[model samples]
Target: MADSPLPDKLDNARVLIYSHDTFGLGHLRRCRTLAHALVEQYKGLSVLILTGSPIIGRFDFKARVDFVRIPGVIKLHNGEYTSLGLHIDLQHTLKLRESIILHTAEAFEPDLFLVDKEPLGLKGEVESTLKLLKQKGVATVLGIRDVLDAPHLLRPEWESKGAGAALQEYYNEVWVYGDRSMGNPLEGLGLPAQIEQMTHYTGYLQREVPESVPSKHLLGVPQNYLLITPGGGGDGVEMVDWALRAYELDSSSLPHGLFVLGPFMALAEQQAFRERISRIENASLVTFDNRMESLIDNAAAVVAMGGYNTFCEILSFNKPALLIPRTRPREEQLIRAEKASDLGLVSLLDPRKGIDATEMHRALQALLKQSPPRELVADCFLNGLDKVCQRALALMPRS
Candidate 1:
């Protein structure tokens, strides 16, 4: 792009990221991390994120990175989606979202396009945009998390949406932010050999928390206390509540439990959690923190619901984490937790089988006594940001 006589700086090369955020903050977080990483790597590089995440404004952004907030949609428990606040029909809302996305890409004229997860996006909202970008010779990338839904669920879901076809035609490269020994996000989809060859395992994304940021003391959490979280907290009520329940059972054993309830959790449930916190002596609560990387950094050990970004943070920080993975909604988290536990990267509690308060306490105690688990640290790669930046720059010439 810099070679096109546009601007002198190599930062003239830009990247456009799309996140079809149906539910949680995972998609948005991953995109923002990548945007920040790329911007930091190049002097004049600029990154624009097109996202439907409701809480996108809550986080601070880097100088060369910003976001365009697309109209949001919420996924219902019944698997149907509704406009976040608009009275318009879901179809009409999607049309509006599509227009904003396509128009932004056209105006931004990025040298590279990174589409998160869903190849075609929600109901194929990003399809036209993908087509137009490719026609303009944009290097389109599909940046998927380590594990998508289990193969059985993912295959049919992709087939129904015709995502396989888009992957074959629109995208130039498929980057899986995980190690292959973990699991392929596209396994069992029966992708053609060419599509498979286009895929690259970029390893787990590495996250860092700046040391100068406000400390855990701000949350009333003492040093050496357990840090517990459910990233974005909408679907994490079960796990978050379980931590509170465990604390209630024995505050002495698990003193000073710090719970960062994500903003997406239902108000009533958050209020319920607050009521429990008021009754408990040692535990404190904060609704949300944009810089959760800092919280994870200072953690004695982490108890997290296994989301991709959370897992990445745990891996990068080398925090001893206990995962309580949700079985329903998609088996991706469950599968990831199981494998990570097998590798001794972290431990897990299967929500389906439902370990009780005593078992939860035992896990917490074990974590305090033990060095944070890291049997496979050398085996897995967490330097994905560097690789992504390299691949992205190579797509566009510097000179």
Candidate 2:
């Protein structure tokens, strides 16, 4: 790829983001956050995100920040890919996604093309789009979260996917959305120096309190309650179960628990969770909330599985949190939880060891005693959004 010269001036630049939202809400949420931040920073800039999230319509979007919903696909628990709500083969669904992605790129003609998580998209679905954009000299960036997974797991996964070669061949820049002090997503990948030179650590994206909030009636709970969220709740059943067990074990004078079980949780699991929580007087369950930042901000404290988005919110809102990270499928959350615990940002509770009601009860009590994240970290730790805007400007055509 040839170096694209920096332009002389800025104008109504356009940006396109691709989010291969196969499993959880993380990819789509991250892309949406960036899209909102970018358009807010640049007056005339518009960001159009291409996502495969079935619930994309559920989330609210600001003006000049919109999404194009491609054919939705989902990842099954057994690590198989299948179309979401469509009775078709996975290959056909992938082909449809790829065509829509390329078509959107051609029509949008964005000045900057940003991709979230998957370097080459799900099964290299975005490979052709990236190549076409590179040929057109559209600046391409790969945005990744703080921790992908354990090195052992990530290495084989990337090797099989040819992520390193794609990074070197297609991307103009790689943005790690995390502080290097916390963790590096690309730590042991052993990519070439060219990829390293083009990479930037943009820190974690900061979340803000939403302008609109759900009323107490809508939330089915009052303020100043303890928030328990298993982000996206697909793999969060354990966390939720543990929390409920804790409450059941000791219905002491602890804070009221409000659980946001996430949207992707299985129907049977959700029903079971509801039944369990119904018996617990101090706990209330909400299956999902699109505007979760509000709940996080308003909480007295938080108990959650340490997903990337939740980590950002915990810091952004400076809440005292206890993270019970999952260790299977991927150790990304576990790695992040360990790092945050080391940094004194949050407390860690590994479910691998044991999540008995007694242990969970102790953790809940400990959460309130822990200091808020901002008190421990520097004030500038939440400057990821500002830095990302600056980096976007540098990569974008100013003319």
* Pairs of colliding residues, candidate 1: 11-44
In the range 1-399, model 1's lDDT, one tens digit per residue, is 011222325647788999989898899999999998888777788899999988899888989899999999999998899999789999999999999999999999999999999899899999999989888888999999889988888888888998888999899999999988787888899888888899988888888884586754455567777888998898888898778878888988774888889989889999999999999888888888888888888888899988999999888777888999988878989999999988888888888988788888888887776556554665347768777877887787565
Model 2: colliding residue pairs = 9-398
Against the hidden reference, what TM-scores do the models get?
0.95, 0.95
Candidate 1 has an lDDT of: 0.85
Q: Each candidate: how many clashes?
A: 1, 1
Q: Cα RMSD (Å) per model?
A: 3.4, 3.7
**Tens-digit per-residue lDDT, 1-399, candidate 2:** 111242323467999999989888899888989988877777788899999988999999998888899988888878888899779999998999999999999999999999998899999999999999999999999999889998998999999999999998899899988888886688898778888788788777899866765534235576678999998988988888898888999866568899889998999999998998889887888888888888888898999899999999999888999999989989999999999999988898888888788888888898878889888776556677777788889888766
How many collisions between residues are there in candidate 1?
1
Q: Residue 303, candidate 1: how far off, in angstroms?
A: 0.5
